[model samples]
Target: MSLYQTSPAVAEALAQGRPVVALESTIITHGMPWPQNLEMARTVEQTVRDAGAEPATIAVMDGTLYIGLTDDQLVALAQAQNVAKLSRADLAACMAMGGTGATTVAATMIAAAQAGIAVFATGGIGGVHKGAELSFDISADLPELAQTPVNVVAAGAKAILDIPKTLEVLETQGVPVIAVGQDALPAFWSRESGIKAPLRMDQPAQIAKAFAMRRALGLPGGQLIANPVPEADEIPADVMLPYITQATAEAEAKGITGKSVTPFLLQRIFELTDGRSLKTNIALVLNNARLAAQIAQELSALP
Candidate 1:
């Protein structure tokens, strides 16, 4: 039996050489509350479609890797409790145990590559946690981008992380971090992280050409397109900084570590911002989906 399965829409699109934008399922299962999560998932998928690309939302259900989900499956996943958040280290284990899992950036890239999808869109990528010098904690997403051949379009690393160190790690891994329409790296929820991006490409065709060029050169990894959140929806860096600092401090005081830290910080930030953070998250994800669809369309036009 094949380990992977694709929804009819995604399969048809792939077979027909059409543009398809891969989506991560963590946002549905772990990023938000029930009905809203389901709503967000549908909206994001539709956003990709509206941009002239098919959407493939990846996940693992009963040991089977689903390249895209059916409506019923999306509902079940949104309502499912305690779904394992799968990443590079435990994705296989979750599958072996027949557990349902939400794909993180790393796992999503792995799945997208396996399914031959060239682009993915997400709210943000995980990165070096604050105070990583002591915890030595870093997200596998960085290393995955260094090896996986999927172009990831995100608002940038989550604002709660150490954005500067994350960029350094990406640079060290020989990954291309391209900022779209701007020279500054976007800190998730904010339009600018204040650290200049190493590369900037204004057009989707430019990003597509870079991807093609990398493949032609036999580069192992994918590129990170740091698309900024729409300015109307962004929470300026200065306004977000204190909230992030407080949330990080709270997490540390509570001894929240590993995978728990991000969710905790996000929830706390949501509270601290009077629910504004979640709204910003949704806005940024939609922005990324739009850009990813454009990039996928360009890539599909390539030879």
Candidate 2:
């Protein structure tokens, strides 16, 4: 039996060798609430379509991994509660148990590669959390990128993570961190992280060529393309830092750890920012979707 199913649209696109961008379902299941999550999902997918690539929004429903969700399945996943957030560690177990779950970056990349999709877009990749020395709480995303052959487009690591340390980890793993059109990496809700990005590319085609070259060289992993949010939509690193600090402190104080840390900090930051952070999150995600689509288009055109 097949372990997964592709939506008709995604199957057609793959068969035709058209560009298809992989999108994660965690944003719908764990990143936002209700109608807004559904709306963001729809908007992000449409943004990819407008930019000339098919969007494959991946998830697992009742043990069946889905490469792309239809509208009804999208709505159902958006509305589903207590959904398991599946990462590399738990994705197989969730599937084995006949469970419903949303794919995190690691799981999404695995699913995308399985479906033969080459690019993925998300708000931000998880990274080495603050105070990770004692907790050892690095995200599986870093390791996944070192092995998965999919280009992941994001604003950057979440602003709340230890950005410098995150970069250190990515470098150690031999993953390319390419910031688009900038010298600095973006910090999720903010457009700048104040640290220099290791590499920079100015255009989608530039990124696409690098991706293809990596494959030609028989490289094992994908590159990370840090696509900054639109300037008008960014919260500005300086403006966002204090709120992030406060929220991180609150999470640490309240004993929030592991997978729960990100959600907890984000909610607290959302409240502290008077909901501005959420707006920025949505904007960055849409921006990443657009870039991922263009990159995918360029990739599809490659020999």
Candidate 3:
């Protein structure tokens, strides 16, 4: 792998042993519309800062991996058409070929671990898509988390996926799923998945200690801190189920699959909910960012 050049701000933070939270880039390019996406990207980064850490949002431009983007780059990327969505399988290819790409959760984790940033914040992790039993359409995120040593804070698996199966896969792969301040695993956009988390940690310091212990034990995989969305911001599982079913059915009817499926489903859900989903999504991501920053701070305190 080519040496990744960390941004000046991120480099200094790492050198000083200050907390740094890594962020994925697909949310900016594939998850939202232009101006709003750019605004949300900046807001998420600022939230991490407000919570006492620097945010390092990862992406690729002309094959160079960037730890953080300048304002102009963020805006241009948000509005740019035809950007590649990079994941574990394709990340190296993009960098090697000198192509611009947005980092997904899997790619972000790889970059974060390489940069020595132990914590990452994202809206949600991808998982076993519905009908994966037949389609075999699982996300690379599972294996990425199974090997990379980053502490990922997310609202849980995206609501569009099969939550139980996703949890099962994570368990089988030996990744820790620790719920923050809750017993039930959270479903993105909703506060409850009605499934209890395998592990629970109420304090960021406790979670940080867990990561430390994992390293001490020579564990290979990372940890997934499943932080639930704030109650006021949640859509509730019941209220969201029918909408998700309808959106999934529509996607199937249109034969949208693979990389196109997620964006299509999210857009359909946004239209179906009159943009409430997007609003809830933004809230959940910011909440996750705040929690990730706190965890990063805690981790930084470790020897």
**Cα-based TM-score, every candidate:** 0.99, 0.99, 0.98
The deviation in Å at residue 15 for candidate 2 is: 0.1
- lDDT top scorer: 1
Where in model 3 is the C-alpha error above 4 Å?
none
TM-score, predicted candidate 3 vs. hidden true structure? 0.98
Query: Which sections of candidate 1 miss by over 4 Å?
Result: none
Per-residue lDDT of model 3, residues 31-130, tens digit only: 8887888999999999999999999989998889998777787888898888899999999999999899999999999999998999999999999999
Whole-model Cα lDDT of every candidate shown, in order: 0.95, 0.94, 0.93
lDDT of 1 by residue, 1-303 (tens): 777999999999999999999999999998888799999999999999999999999999988899999999999899999899999999989988999999999999999999899999999998898789999999999999999999999999998999999999999999999999999999989999999999999999999999999999999999999999999999999999999999999999999999999999999999999999999999999999999999999999999
Tens-place lDDT per residue, model 2, 1-303, is 887999999999999999999999999999888998999899999999999999999999999999999999999999998899999999999999999999999999999998889999999999999889999999999999999999999999999999999999999999999999999998998778999999999999999999899999999999999999999999988898889888988887899989999989898999999999999899899889999999999999998
Task: Indicate the residue-level lDDT of 76 in model 2.
Answer: 97
Displacement of residue 268 (Cα, Å) in model 3 is 0.7
Model 3: pairs clashing at backbone N, Cα or C within 3 Å: none
Residue 278 error for model 1, in Å?
A: 0.6
Q: How much does candidate 2 score in TM-score? A: 0.99
Whole-model alpha-carbon lDDT for candidate 2 = 0.94
